[model samples]
Target: MSTPPRPGMESLSLILLRRPPNPPDLSDDEADKIQQAHLDFLDDLRAAGVLGAAGPFRDHDDPTLRGLCVYRTTLDEARHHATTDPAVQAGILIADPITWWFREGEIHLA
Candidate 1:
């Protein structure tokens, strides 16, 4: 049997990164700028100890699986962070938040 979660354990949020249905027509430079901004945002989160892991999929053409961010934060805060991404604000991408649960110390990244 699985053990129940202990009280006061923090919950995590998973941000499902996806491309918008009708992405804005942006020049290469504009797209690069937005991408950099998004990276900076994630870096900040990592520095703040909120971001656990984040990365994009290999297939850029895939509509369903674009990228993801697993963070230690409330759902509202995760949504706020997701909306802060320049790509999301520009309608180039969308972030859907989902509450996640995992055993502590089990999820690690290199």
Candidate 2:
């Protein structure tokens, strides 16, 4: 048995993170710097309560599929936030919105 979703909950947006087909070649230091910037970007979103959840994918069917970001906003808003990430801007990671239907209260990030 499972509990059904309650009424009146808000919807959340989802964005899938992936490695570009032809990701830019960068030195290890450059890559690390971009990664750090990406983390800082996510932290900013968290502080602003825009990112409900975000993380990297360890094992996936497609190796290029890197991670996911669940946003507490509409699809457009989510896209706006994701596309602004330093990694995405640098072509280190790409973001694609995926339609995901779930009540907002269903997820929370500490």
Candidate 3:
């Protein structure tokens, strides 16, 4: 018997956050503290599967992180989760999330 086709995955929204510019007068310690808090928040999101990947943008020297997250259900849920993230709560990151649709090709996520 032939295998049945897999069900389609719904398009999900992705949240992208960028770190604020560092003040010329801000101390390194202060920056470290902020980063730590953001890390803690990301840990929570990872546990919840709301965050796919969270890391610093390595295209150049800066505190910006190129992040992406897939919402489990609806756009609202994704927004709620992103807003509640530690980085967002601590003001370490600001999110501009966008909805995206994708189809599985040779690789499968299921």
Candidate 4:
């Protein structure tokens, strides 16, 4: 047997993170500090169950920060929460809000 899709609608999503087109101009010490803060933020999100996955995307020799964070709520909610993240507050990321969507294979209702 196969599972059926849920009726009605599902939650909206947003991806908020920073990605430099080129290499960052941060000193080694500054980089370390920012990285630590980013890790800590991820920890917080994971604990909250709002973070499905996250990581950086490197292209060529430039170290561009291409990361993703999945939030289980509407775009507005995601944006609000993301803006409050320590990484965003630390100026480490030029957080961009992108609204996206996906189909749920099976949704459990209580």
State TM-scores per candidate: 0.79, 0.84, 0.62, 0.65
Model 2 TM-score, all chains together: 0.84
Please, what is the whole-model Cα lDDT of each candidate in the order they appear? 0.81, 0.85, 0.63, 0.64
Q: 41-81 in candidate 2: lDDT tens per residue?
A: 99999999998889989855898999999887878889898
Q: Which ten residues in a row have the lowest lDDT in candidate 1?
A: 1-10
Highest TM-score scorer: 2
Given candidate 3, what's the lDDT at residue 25?
Answer: 45
* Model 4: residue 106 alpha-carbon error in angstroms: 7.6
> Which stretches in model 2 have alpha-carbon errors above 4 Å?
1-10, 103-110
Residue-pair clashes, model 3: 0
Q: How accurate is candidate 3 locally (lDDT)?
A: 0.63
Q: How large an RMSD does model 3 have?
A: 6.9
Ranking by lDDT: 2, 1, 4, 3
47 in model 1: Cα distance from truth in Å? 0.9
Q: Is candidate 2 or candidate 3 better by lDDT?
A: 2
Pick by lDDT: which candidate is best? 2
What lDDT tens digits, residue by residue, belong to model 4 across residues 16-101? Answer: 47654544578888878878877887788778777666667656464444576666666666777777766566666766766553
lDDT tens per residue, model 1, 1-110: 12337743435688998887788899999999999998998999899898889999885667666899987777888888898887789888889998866666666644
Candidate 1 lDDT for residue 72? 73
Ranking by TM-score: 2, 1, 4, 3
